[model samples]
Target: MSSSSPSLARAPHHDGSVTYLGPVPTRPGGSVRLRVHVPAPGASRVRVRWGQDGEPRLRDLTPTPAFDGQWWTGELPLVNARTSYRFLIEGPDGARHRWLTAEGVSEREVSDRSDFVLDASDAAPDWVADQVAYQIFPDRFARSAAAADRELPDWAVPQAWDEPVVAAGGPVARQLYGGDLDGIAEHLDHLVDLGVTTLYLTPVFEGRSNHRYDAVSFDRVDPVLGGDDAYRRLIDAAHARGLRVLGDLTTNHTGSGHEWFRAAAADPTGVEAGFYLFDDQGYHCWLGHPSLPTLDYRGRELRERMYGRADSVVARWVDAGLDGWRIDVANMTGRQGGVDLTREVARGVREAMTRVNADTWLLAEHFFDASADLVGDGWHGVMDYAGASMPLWWWLAAPGARPHATVPLPIDPLPARDVVATMREVHARYPWAAVTASTVHLDSHDTARFRTLAGGGEHGGVDDGSSDSGLARARHLLGAGLQLTLPGVPALFAGDELGLTATTGEHARTPIPWDARETWDAATLDAYRELVALRREHPALRRGGLRWLSAGVDHLTFVREHPAGRVLVHAVRPRPDGAAPRDGEVRLPAAVLGGDAADAVTLRGEGLVRLDDGDEPVLALPGSVGAHLWLLPGDDLAWT
Candidate 1:
């Protein structure tokens, strides 16, 4: 906080608050409570204009006589089509409108594209919204002695357990450090200690490549990784420890070595030939990569083999006790050139999962804007790179942190205000369920490690590392605070909690150095543990309503209101100038305390605030490098 002095509150009404839009996650044929808050408690009349892309219908709102409040409401039913809505309020002055978009309030007309979007066809597993995910790359995590005792495949280049990994697509990609299912099973305790509820593994099916996107088969777990039985054992063990394991699946394509592909190549007229986009010119492969032949959904036979049937590959794994499937390259699946059936394929998978386990999650991996597919229809959630991580990089990482970031390449530093707005835009497109269930991460196997970006190392085309180790470490902790405090199923890329540093993602994938505890950043790990515990312990923090309570040039503060309680997260960035930043003050929203800043704050002698009823708590800041968290009682939370 810059100062402890109280400041007048900004009017918080009609700005993405439930007070303005109630009973969120609007569904088809269901009524939603649309309310608008104003400076004054009551208005003469309020109208809601809702419709499809080009047409809109209006309904007059009647004030609820029950418990009179500032929020004027209209209850209306949504139809079968995609819904878009805005409010028209009638106050003493005249008629004015309120456009509630992901970008917050706008009086002028916003394109139907920007209107609040609701896809009732889309709904994620309710359980995922409140859980955190822990990502593990099976090839480089930890190798149990049992896995180490196995023979190496001819295609794999064996290396010592502690050796650094080489990054390349051919033989280098084929190298193995021997981490396997048993190793993850052995480490369930560590994940549990970190308060993780989900164990998300990279590809583990029969495959030769270290990343395993090039799978030879879908039904069997690679024997080198302890095969099918090991997968079951891992699943059973993970379940015993109250953790769920989701395996990776590549529906976009299959390796050249896959039996169907090999057979199809030899006999174009064979039963499997239709699986590939084969023609007189040749077959189509993902990104024109010859080894990864794109699967053709035109072939019902292929769709049935993959996800359509109860006996399909998807069902086999779900029945094998795996909790879910993480669709690899989901952006490319069922999409080639202008042709697309991505939703059909995805919906097929969702139906298959429903057959096996109604609670099973279905996540898609897309570095770009996945809103086209994430509209709540098929995918339970997404590895939400576009929505969260990339925007963060644009703000926190160096301008040149590209080729290293997954999408929306970081070419320049984004203003703090722009970052918050972009996040709101991405978040507003989905229903509350998908928004909360989306997976948010700092770095993963597909990109350079986040710490590397913080270190600003230029190793391998990456131009990051603009700060010294000490300051970089603090920023990383702040990143953790933001990731955990913001929405999404917060995920850790295996070694991130240990303050792992790397030049590139490949280096970041270095085998977990179990023997190098003396060299680890213990403080970073402890902070991560605390943040995860914070998420685990509070239901509100896990799944809550978010409001940007305060934002400034060098500082940001937000409140997450949940049913269990409300929590505040504040983070700061180093000043660009080579001078100390002045102290900052963050004024909590009056709506949060159910009164104005000067009004005696509610929840006195309750929640995390220790002040008496008359004292309003204000955040006082010290320096630039800081992150703070506080929990407050939610039941007493009200916007008066």
Candidate 2:
């Protein structure tokens, strides 16, 4: 339970790598080979304690013939739906026993809840981990000429494409810019050139607000966004360019104007009334927002209408060509007061979607700890804001800055060690597949833009191409590098690569400045493009297991290990004196660098120099906010 050092030396390490665990999507009821690396002789013996038919079972691990004396190998029975296991390492003379769970090595007995889990239920689609997703807020992305002809709803306060976005007051949600699907279809080449593999569009259903979380109907796309035909065109265009498209769905609640809500409010005695919680006082709304009415999943009719049936909303969308869905407020879905059908709803939706298309990638939007909900049967993964974004925000945030209004509590900048620890601890709770499939992003439609958080412009302020934006842009690229290289699907908010800045979620919805190329931050855009390309080209960054190497105050080093190859990542921010840090030396096992005969390493990005002509590798870290990814050479076992 105490803090664990991030250093690789003397640490027992295990990840989802093929070297550690074999045959991803571990076979049900089949023996799976597992390995653990104990770099030092701190333990005389090691054993794997796993779950079996409601009881605990132990199996001895023998030392592998290679990697000198660090590697130990064993096989897990995989008898349960979710196989939970941890290592029991005995010190010399069987003293100072240490338990190694997903949380790291603990000297005392620890909770088994943090134990590494291998789900025998189902894995995410094979493509989920490999995708580099780009998220677009529908109304703010772009507006085609065709969009100007469409009539806006009475609730809309239309604005020109170049007008300032109203980031505050009640009018913020009503200021619509009329971006449509056709507009997005026109920009397919931009996304392809940026090297993103998937396009994640925010809700397109008929909604009252510019953000569209408040859907009035699930049956069709908003007419103002060029209707269902435009939607088809966008999907076809994206797919033609080898990109997958995902849609957002709000399952936790519906806009008060939704047809189902209207029907229930009009007739209390009707069958539609059962779809929501209706008491004598009034109906229950999500988080007390009257405009957004929460759904009650206790009744079978609501379930059948949402996702339980072949003709349900969930199935209809997949049939319409959505590669997957990102369920909004999924943590609150089906759990209000005494009724709790969250799990059942997730499983039902997954079943319904897969029936239409087996490869559908389902993701949940959970802002807080989502480990308990990601057991592999329901959502393929979560947005991972709690594990990835929140920690990275603290690490990259400027002094006295907060993430956004939604995250009201103040978060001071975190040291690299604490950030790494937070991320490691939170990720340890998820099944390996869930961890890999989760979205790793800096910001999203519901949060402040990363550039603003890193001290770019005023909170919610638009980009002005000012010199003050340099710090924000550098830190933004630093975080973007981590997002792309981490053990998850990297997602880039639409305008983040273009140096966008915002103080809050509403302000963050500034329209993409496609026409104003001169105002763009070309350097930032190039960094994103290069990073995305690196991730796509290297198997280690796309589908590799992560191993922490070292964590310093201003720098972090890790290695992504894949069977085909290995990559070393070193990320550093500027020192207090604004000089490049020199103490970035991290010694790896000789085997990790291909034992003495390792091939030459290729460096990407700025501020890393190889001084490895001597004994071990020593790196000169970046003088500014920068990152370096080294393509390492190694064989399957010894890396020689």
By TM-score, the best candidate is 2
TM-score to true structure, per model: 0.89, 0.94
Query: What are the per-residue Cα lDDT tens digits for candidate 1 across 398-483?
Result: 54655363454554766566788788777666655566667898888877777766653433222222335665666677778788
Clash tally, candidates in order: 13, 3
Instruction: Tell me the tens digit of each residue's lDDT in model 2 across 1-640.
Output: 1121334534777876665887744346777888887764545888999988889999999875444346778888887778889999887666788888887888888888879988887788888878999999889898899998898999999998888876678799999888999999998899999999999999999999887888999998999999899999999999999999999999999999999999999998887799888888798998888899999988899999999888899999899899999999999999997888888889999999999999999999998888778875799999989889998988887766677665677767778888999988898889888888889989988888888888888544345445766667777888998999999899999999888888777888989988887878888888889999899888889887888877767778788877667887878765434565544444444443333324536558653355566655544434345788777654645322
Candidate 1 local distance difference test against the native? 0.70
For model 1, state the Cα shift of residue 41 in Å: 7.2
- RMSD versus native structure for model 1: 4.5
Q: After superposition, how far is residue 626 of candidate 2 from its true place, in Å?
A: 1.2
Tally clashes: model 1. Answer: 13
- Candidate 2 residue 30 Cα shift, in angstroms, is 2.7
Q: What TM-score does prediction 2 earn?
A: 0.94
The 0-to-1 C-alpha lDDT of every candidate, in the order given, reads 0.70, 0.82
